[model samples]
Target: MPSRSAAGVDRRTFLRYTSAIGVTTAITTGLTACGGPASNGDGAKGSGGSGAGTIEAGLSYALSTGFDPMITSGATPYAANMHIFEGLVDLDPATLVARPTLATEMPKKINATTYRATLRKGATFHDGSAVTAEDVVFSFERVLDPKNASLMAQFVPFIDTVKAVDTGTVEFKLKSPFALFPSRISVVRIVPKKIVEKDVKGFDAEPVGSGPYKFVSAVREDKIVMTKHDKYNGPHPAKAQKMVWRLMSDPSARVSALKSGRVQAIEDVPYIDVKGITGENKVESVQSFGLLFLMFNCKDERFEDKRVRQALHYALDTEKIIETALLGNAAPATGYVPATHPDYRKASTVYSHDLAKAKKLLAEAGAKDLSFTLMLTDTGWVKDVAPLIKESWAAIGVDATLDIAKSAAQYAKVDKGDFHALAAPGDPSVFGNDVDLLMRWFYYGFWPEKRYGWAGSAAYKKTKSLLDQAAGLTDEAKRKELWGQVTDLVADEAALYPVLHRKLPTGWTTDALTGFKPLPTTGLSFIDVGRA
Candidate 1:
């Protein structure tokens, strides 16, 4: 699931490593030459018939991970999971509004700390098993089990126990009053107990769910195939009977595929090509909460002092980078929440570019003559932003050496405390849009406790407490007020702060497909899309 930062682009690593191994040529030879557009595992021609609708699209990312909604983190597979698996309630692909999917309607509140949901009648998994209350209970239990290490568990800390009330009804008992309980049910997707209980690892590779589409076959960095679940009786029925996601990691290749009539839509459209692609193809840059985050190894002596972290944020020319490096396709990260979010609130401690303030803070922290290695991911946009960060720090009398590498490789160093700081793209928007969920993604759980080395600190403990208090509060205004307090403290400390929120650019032939809107998250979604 995206809860684990899956399929989020480590764009440069995917492109570079694939190119080095002749992956581009391999993809071309494997897919293009097999009959026509999409190829099945047996190298057989796809059922791209006229009446039975089919949509072929290019994705900027490769299948670098699994498709399990509980643990999958790669952007490509995360997107695919949306089509194959569904929760009781789901965030609409475009609007982020909570909508009922597996359940007949929103989970009704039985009490302040309990909720009840009745599964939709006749709903069945792709394997043809009935969608029973036992299945729902099993799904939630799997996530709540600490031994499984399911990333989805972090998002639903309010859930104390999920029990089967009847054959079709399920009840959830919460530890406290959670305002977003109804919508938060979307975090734990319902999976068949029989299938998963037998072969958990095999299910991750070839998933079987009760979603609109059924997984067919997947070849990493090549293609992912799916067919419409004819038995699907959901609100958003599959408009296209089949979907072929061609893994085009190269930006130009995705655009070229759209132009050459090979694909009807493409994701991660290059900023440079937004205006250049004309005629039937159109590009739209959807504003997203996806951000380039700046995090420090808080365990390190130099960054242990919050002032050092603040100094780094103050030194960056954020506005200039957004305008120049991002081609004005991003907004300055003024707060934890982006300007586009409905619940947007500007933090009290907004960091503006000020060299004097940065130097002063460094001096106060006893590190005026500072020098450290800045570890960065090699995503295309991150590469563009890296030099600007270096220049900004250098101007303030700080020597920052750039150590650019793949996200996983860089994280290996970060986890082991071998690096000073990190800059990379991340989007927790997939899990939720609320301030609490967003804050928890970085500050709470495994990320801070294990990876960033901030859990033991006083600041982290206070942050966690504030979040817990906010969760228990039934009043909406009070909850937001507490969130604002958290936003202020985190910003003031500047441990893991955002540099900017980027716009996700996507291109589609408007005339060729219907209901194919651009997404604000990492990967593309075609929930109710069909050929025109």
Candidate 2:
């Protein structure tokens, strides 16, 4: 396996690749808890558990990225960062609905273009610094700075400026009236200004936030150690004394750890093993908005025509792939957004599995014998589904070879415009749930502009204008109407579209862990959850 520089990949690409690294570990590690609070400068050590107060979880992701809320991109780091940091308004771990965390409540809409947030008075960072309006302003400013190249900035283009109105009040003036402004605040988390100002790089390496847990250390491909932040005074306090997230990327290792009592909970449980795990160990497959999407290199002359893209989608037997490869843990994508979402709308051009239509379309497009490399991530589920896809394409006279690698390496090729088509799993629901934010993630920003090569097209420009116009409108029904139009255009274009929306399977000990719920998003959350 070759290594690639992770310099330019976006958050979605970063996390997708992060979850794909399945490094196998033979032994489970125990957390060594700190007796008392540790300063932010000196790293805190985690404590061990006896399946009582302290909790251990086997995560299927490795920490390939940093921990800065503004920039951290990998799956594990993002999950851990959720416990270590918080935003003015944070999404509920189980249900991705935006709620208050650092703020007393969700940001209040003062006017059409302005919103106000009041910080909780007693909240403090892991470093023991007060969470103030200045810190909130600094957090947003750092992300908004172009020189920093923060991945979060793209999601918050509505903010014109963030100013401290008082000690506890922070005001946001938007570039325009963004209807999604309240929920969108979750995108940029609040950070302590002094710690980050001292050394931004150090803060990225050892993040200090006001969440339930404080970061202790992160050993790549091994384990990330965290202890309860004793000083944290907030709504969601740490329920367990310590949490040791063992990075057992291999599926068998995770199940083994869970069964052997080395871990109380485990994420990304294999579909095959779900029925086998019994008694004290409980397994569940919760429906999620996460998906495996097919994106084409529109710049490639072979895929320049819309007909070829649609032909490729039609060629795949999605229903069969869902049943066989996913073991009935997923639903075939009916539209741009999944049906589980609140704003789900069926697209006008839905691709049902049709091999005959695919062959006809291929012949019409003058591509009777087409051959292309289908790039994919090394995620356990994705590898299982990759062959099924190849076989489906083969049935339609398409020679599709697999280019399987860690997500970072595969995306390196995608980023450089060196790949023809890609099929990979992604979870953008972590950032937001609205149709506009979800659509804009791939179609509006750097993704379309750089990676997919569709920004220059007239269709792409029209989609952008429609999204912009919709964002300004205060009417909810009219906004969705415009969003439906964008979905129709993208689905018909087929440059990038979903194959299926999957159910995230997570297994945990019913007796050992309490209040632990499976999340619809990629990462795990332990807020308000405890060990039995």
Candidate 3:
């Protein structure tokens, strides 16, 4: 089981809460003024003079998890880790292309199942400890250790062993040949073995990594702060002296923060405000793999039949949800991956809104008078669409009781197999953009095995086999072909499938920040961004 805070929500339930405290802090703190100074007594001092000033930005998600990269799944903390941590290889925050971080370059292939990487010379952690090969091995080992229940463990299942070949060199031996090994290893960030072993809990709260920024302090549903790591010698050095990420879950608060010049950037820009904000700031709605999905509890007898699952999917008027709730900012999901994805291939079964078809499927499955409580997270946009979802199902004579709550509470129920159906947002593209990585995020690992209760089914076995087969193939066409098959299979089954692939709208000021680019996935990245 994944670790949860006292609030019973795992880090994975990112963007799940709208805290009154966050709104109150935004209002009472007087963040409305132009060019407000950094928080009083923030203690963020750095040697990066002149051009480097504090970069204040507004983040939409509350801090629901710790900073530990191995276990964190919260969107805000994950974005914070991007500035605070580094992998042997890391995805470019804006483009998601894998690039060498601690490693000299991408890991060099030694054999079919072996790869080697040498640490960058003079690379040191935030605490000034030298980044060593042993630390790299320790990082991967901890994630691979099943007892740890790392959220990232499912991303790197091919690895068999990782060992320090020398003081500066680390080697990996895979259980099988995996073509994406070099880039895939980006999922595991290197951590100091000595520090982590001494105090894992403290380390999770205040993580120490070799990235360009160092963690400072964080207040749940309030704010998170970081300072530039002056000692960093990596490719993307922190250009700003310090950073303050305000946890503003309210959409209007984020908009007000950006418009009032309190924040240089803000993510998850409410679609309704796009036109209004674009006149004053830079707003871009990039097509992303982030999606609102419909998931069923397969263990529930009413949903055991594939027809029942498909019927629920067919009942959704996804286009209406996109237009009414999202204000034309999202697309109906055509496949497992968004149609904008490079490896996208349309699933054979496309459930365009058909009330009659939904009725027929329910009847065929002997599921008449189908009634179940539909659970959902109270994300701003998700709340706007929840009633529409119920209305759609009602049209097919299926009564749906909407159970809307915070993300943590909902996922707590989900992980315990206590729900009939769930509609929530997910985006694995934050980790990587490849089809294999995205598909495996939901279908292959903890998801099918634990959350959805589909692990023992024959379809689950076949889906896993196809993903494994795709992972090993070096031929691009063959891998894509296999992925397409898996997409079609999952789409037809409709066990856990995306309802719509939403666009990620981000707002930033051109004059206040330089070298800033909106990420296509969830969360904002300020890796190379500097205060103007």
Candidate 4:
């Protein structure tokens, strides 16, 4: 195991990474939740549930967690706060539409270097301050600041600058002819300029937003409570006055809470619990964009060889992970980057579970007694399946020690390139349907640390060159043509690999809530809910 800088990503791999690609620009609307027959609302009025008064929902996330979305990292916890915070625009889960939130509509493209956006009418922050062009510009600037340590900064730094032109409009300038601007806008979740200015420390204290819900109170590590803001000016009615977000850490405990009627909703249901519940016996079965995978550190000397990489790829059993580990709730996949996104590349130059090929490649590479520490963290999927993988690899003469990292340590390790191989999940956005992000993350020669997995591969230089050519091609036909070639090259040589994947599932008692659609990326949509 070596750091990204220590692993040798040569110039060749860098060229290939730059020239490689897959592009996606849009997302899908989520699933719909209709009240169930076992519903607790008891036809109260909406959903036949008595009436919408106070909705008590249980989230596996602890409250009092910091307001830093990028810091939190994981999909479940990040999504909990995402429900309350909003940005310049919002993705409508039902229609796969991007609607104006703080801003009224899409930004106007001025030229290859700049674009301008018009603000929405009468949008105000929860703190009584009017949200205007200034706030939008400030929000983007804050995230881009290196000191802020926003994980989002890695993606947004491409833009040269963001500025306000007038009262209702703002402008953005990019260094190059970047086209995925809208997709980037979708993730830069807006924060109130007033709140951060007042006290950066108190940001977690009910940060103001124009969303339908307002932060009420929260206890660190336990739960966060949000009440419906009366001043919310949206098309829908917010049924529940108080949204009690309970932070239950245990997955089984979350299930128990749902069964006992303690919490109305929970996300990230362990795949093991899916069959016992859902009943098909009438609860809504939520199929989300939940993607799970094993990450290889190309920074490691052992993984530098392409044959070794391919051998490792073919040794695992994805179908078994889906059936035995996930129980048919997910799809066995290979590189569904920007998972479930509308424009992601589907036809793979890189998908095969060929064990024989894997064995042959290992022998060819002279990788005798191949072994490394395979780091995994505690979770339903990993806990159940990491052992199976260890055994699978062992049978293939590759010994792997299952080293599990604690939550905090795990986050630190991956971000710092501290391990050889680890199990990590990525819910990434590709503002453009092209492969800039795909290539930069996996194959960039200059930033081995940034290249998702191939940071230390010997072929990095060549990969980066290919990526530059792919990105520079403004011609649509040739760009796609070059992208196809890039895809073929990486499918054979790169380090980013997908193991087993499952659909993210959320549990909600139909009695107290309505309009709960589960998104693949984020956990739940708060604005869409109403007193049912």
Candidate 5:
């Protein structure tokens, strides 16, 4: 089978494709534990026990997108889907380890290019419909359909077809022998066929799934409410009777909400407020693959030269940026993936802070007195780092005008090929933890093809070839070797590369919640968490 390409998709499709998989942004807050059942301004009661009370959380991202697991890219909705949907296999909220959720166990290998899984008996969707082989087959089919243009399609390009072998068993045929097939399929969450076909738009607005929680209601930029799926017969059942997720994008509001005991937990704890929150609550910062990357428009003459790109990367005082801006909560990008990742391998080309090297590279590329508008998203964290970035570039004789705006606006300029360079936060690790998935998110798909204008470059072709080779290999060591090579190539090219990987800081009241843990990814998860 030939490798999939994004060549034929139109401009509108390209925009939707990029927007549907918009990068997950970082958020932060602080919480104080309440001694008993906590009551919100609305008189909603929250506490911990089986089917006992509500679990109120102050989420950072607004409802920018819908709830469909197939295409929803907004961090808050994606996190909400964790409670409302499940794949044949689902990753543990805390550890990110793939485990059997709707399936009886992990998909069993039938051959080099085929695998089969049996549904867990008695598992039913939140709407009281039994989850069957048809549902699983339909779920994968919609995502695999090119006409549907699912963002998830890019991740599972190896899949040839999916069929229901029986009412309870589903089979998958891959075009190539993929070693990570079991865990990789976790990207496509299973949804009921009849309801989706009847009303996809309605389904997108309000989702239904076989997880521990059922979608109740969602108001954009306000709150999302859900009730426990009492019929859920899965391993991780909802511990709280109800859940109220208050969408508080303002860091101060989230902090105040948590501190006042209106919410039990909050994520994306502000780096500056970490110390203050730590004195009264449990604040844990987990190093994640989430990163602030610098992307160059390879189509632009000034940035088309790889040396110019490399020079810009070398110019940044990453240590100072992390120390002053992030409060030392991030690590400089040594590789495409974070050092904490299991499959992480040091890239051959590590860009250390060297002003002299940066200047030399600029001169070699004939980019003397370089001036460009550095576009960036107005995410709170990104805004904090914006001036520092300009200062770093200024030291190397580069006049960088910072153009800061919301993610949508900045990305609009990027999508139209109207921008020079952009520094933005992205975390694709929320989908899966494998190196292939992580690297492919930025390097392989619509990102390089449309957003960054590297699709026509020889380096992009080389990176694609290496990734495709790695995907087809069954041998673990050989696959990783190929991945390492791709990592080194991208790092050296520096077309669109990570500047630093951030530590996802989360704050929660220790005595207010049980079985709660911080995620390394962008969103919060309450899979097995309960209010106390």
Candidate 6:
């Protein structure tokens, strides 16, 4: 996005009008509370139960899910869990390039279908076994083993086999051609084969890895304490052991915690609270590419009409949503894919607010009594955006209904085609527009063969074949060409609609935090977290 002209950070007329009414436009609130950290949410008290060297941080989700990298990796917003694990390649601070963490170098492609990788000799797991090729092979294989239930396994289905050629060397034989294989291997965090072989539940509770930080202790759904791994490889970490993670479920509670110095680095700063929350001296907010969208179930007869879908798009007041709901931190969306992705058509036309045009389209389709069910989780972010959508559709005479999938049933509902429209937090792509990324979340029959309510209908069946064909080809230009073809077709069909790319915002309390960067997975990790 730095290469393209960044748009509209300044206040707008609508924003000015909203400010007159006293509202937060994904705005920020001043946080000037100064003191040692305290625990705000319900969790085990003290920095650590033992009151040892621990750096305290706050997160949006409870720490019930522990440090099993493969369990909830990128596909979910569990960067905090990933913070406890180290992958083969870590995101470089200056370049944003994938650099080696466990492996010696970028994976070397022996041919169109095979890659050879070598392990970093001195790297050791916390249990002190030299990290070997076998561990890397086991981790990758286990994730793709179907029963492991890894959410981010779709990218590497072609991985036919992973054999440790030697203690330090391994081979990955793919079933098809993949030019971006190295990028795929970069994020798979290595686990000790010995530990997982014994207890899956125990490993999930307390896992060990060769990351910059080592896990100290964790109380399920409450908080986690991590210390700097003194034997960490790569650039010596600036932080010395002392990091604590407190789980704050409510956005306002997270804000209050930051104000009270109860925790450092809170996640999911509501757009309304971005400016005022980060206004504090210690808090710094980073606005990276966030993807948010309202998915249309292709199976539903109501949304199957292109005119009906287009009409819904025409009804939105995107600017107002940003001003009132998101505050001012988010940009309006037009494309189904993220605007920041490499292949995104930056100059493409945007779907601006047009009430008249929406009415006309609906009339043309004889879509007089437009009605649909949009289901989302019961979270603050969903509460803010979904109601705004319902009201916007109502203004155009569309009888839209808002539904809440009970917290426990939400994931199952979305993963299956059980709901009409659901909010999806798609994983961030390093290569940006890899075909797999787009084809998986949308389109008919999602990637890794999960049927999470894709646009499944007669119209989408044709599109899916073309998409599959594109994935099989290795020609870069040809691949880009196919991606454009599918995206254009989807847009022309109005098969999907984007709300806005969801952003993860956090504020730090103590300057003790370092090596913390905005990650693709919007969770906090301790790889670089430490007391100053």
lDDT score of model 1? 0.80
Q: Candidate 1: TM-score? A: 0.91
For all predicted structures, in order, the TM-scores are 0.91, 0.91, 0.90, 0.81, 0.92, 0.80
lDDT of each: 0.80, 0.81, 0.82, 0.57, 0.82, 0.58
Off by over 4 Å in 5: 1-48
Question: How do the residues 1-532 of candidate 5 rate in per-residue lDDT, one tens digit apiece?
Answer: 0001111122244346535434222121221111113223342445556755778898887766567788766677778999999999999878889999999899999999999999999999877889999999999998988767686888899999999999999999999888899998999999999988987766777688999988877877788877788889989998887788998888888888778888888988899888887545788999987888999999999999999999999999999999999999999999999888889999999999999999999999999889999987777878899999999999999999999976667777787999999998877777788999888888986789988899998888999999888888888899999999999999999998999998988988887778889988776888888767
Candidate that scores best on TM-score: 5
Local error of candidate 3 at residue 335 (angstroms):
0.6
Worst 10 residues of 1 by lDDT: 26-35
Q: Of the pair 1 and 3, which is ahead by TM-score?
A: 1
Off by over 4 Å in 6: 1-54, 73-77, 92-96, 235-238, 278-285, 346-349, 405-407, 411-418, 423-435, 447-475, 509-515, 519-521
lDDT of 1 at 33: 13
Candidate 4: segments with Cα more than 4 A from true spot: 1-52, 63-65, 68-77, 93-97, 234-239, 278-289, 338-341, 346-351, 411-418, 429-447, 450-453, 456-486
lDDT of 4 by residue, 189-233 (tens): 777777767755456444556666666555655655566555555
Better of 3 and 4 by TM-score: 3
Better of 1 and 3 by lDDT: 3
Model 3 segments more than 4 A misplaced: 1-51
Ranking by TM-score, best first? 5, 2, 1, 3, 4, 6
Clashing pairs for predicted structure model 1, backbone only: 1-72, 6-73, 6-74, 7-73, 7-74, 7-75, 8-75
